[model samples]
Target: MDVFPDFDGMRGIGNLQSVAGALLMFALIIAVLMLIVCAIVWAIAAGTGNYQIATKSRNGVLVALGAAVLAGAGVTWLNWLIDLGSRL
Candidate 1:
């Protein structure tokens, strides 16, 4: 009994590595854009003495940082899982 599912001839799942790479690239780009926007908002809010807006923008920055970290780690984690599965 094979533990790993046969991926051969699976036309629908075309080029998984390329797909994953593209998705990760997109995620990183989005995260960076979010970070830039958040930084601008925070700066503007602070300059205007709007503490509420500043705080919210700070939170947005954190969320964007978290997303970037997760996206970067996700690929490594997925590779590790695949290696572990193959060893089973």
Candidate 2:
């Protein structure tokens, strides 16, 4: 049995695509901003001899980096999956 997405069978898909694109853009922007803020906070905390805040901010930085990477790669990942499915 052949299984694949029927993009043309859906209505208002263009709206959904636009919304998805906008959301991805917002996510990337937020992730970058978070990364910057977290890095600054980590630096300040470390410089002030605050290990607790420094650790937390360090974790935040990693999380923000992950979020940014995921957001940036999500579209390419999805497309790759779709292409693989079509070949199956």
Candidate 3:
């Protein structure tokens, strides 16, 4: 019988789409909170409160957000991989 070469690719594409959609939703929520925090940080920096503090906080937020997204994607991918393997 004729057959598909890469079942994993199909699963991967689905994972990409699913993760991206979830990320967009997450981004909307993150945007609201980050908007306020970022503004506060910038204001503090502009007001000469602590330049390094503002920079460090900004970097921290980025790392936190990135970690969250990466965790989400990793979980999604692993779940999909397990499900796919089960079907085989």
Best model per lDDT: 2
TM-score for candidate 2, please give it.
0.76
Q: Which one wins on TM-score?
A: 2
Model 2 clashing residue pairs (backbone): none
Better of 2 and 3 by TM-score: 2
lDDT of 2: 0.85
Between candidates 1 and 3, name the one with more favorable lDDT.
1
* Candidate 2 C-alpha lDDT tens digits along 1-88: 9986775665764565567767887999999999999999999999999999999999999999999999989866655655565455
Which ten-residue region of model 3 has the weakest summed lDDT?
4-13
TM-score of each: 0.74, 0.76, 0.47
Give residue 33's error in model 2 in angstroms.
0.4
Lowest summed lDDT across 10 adjacent residues in model 2 is found at 79-88
lDDT of 1 by residue, 1-88 (tens): 7676665545533356567868987998899899999999999999999999999999999999999999888877766765575555
Report lDDT (Cα) of residue 73, candidate 3: 69
Give Cα-based local distance difference scores for all models: 0.83, 0.85, 0.66
Query: Candidate order by TM-score, highest to lowest?
Result: 2, 1, 3
Q: Which pairs clash (backbone N, Cα, C closer than 3 Å) in model 1?
A: none
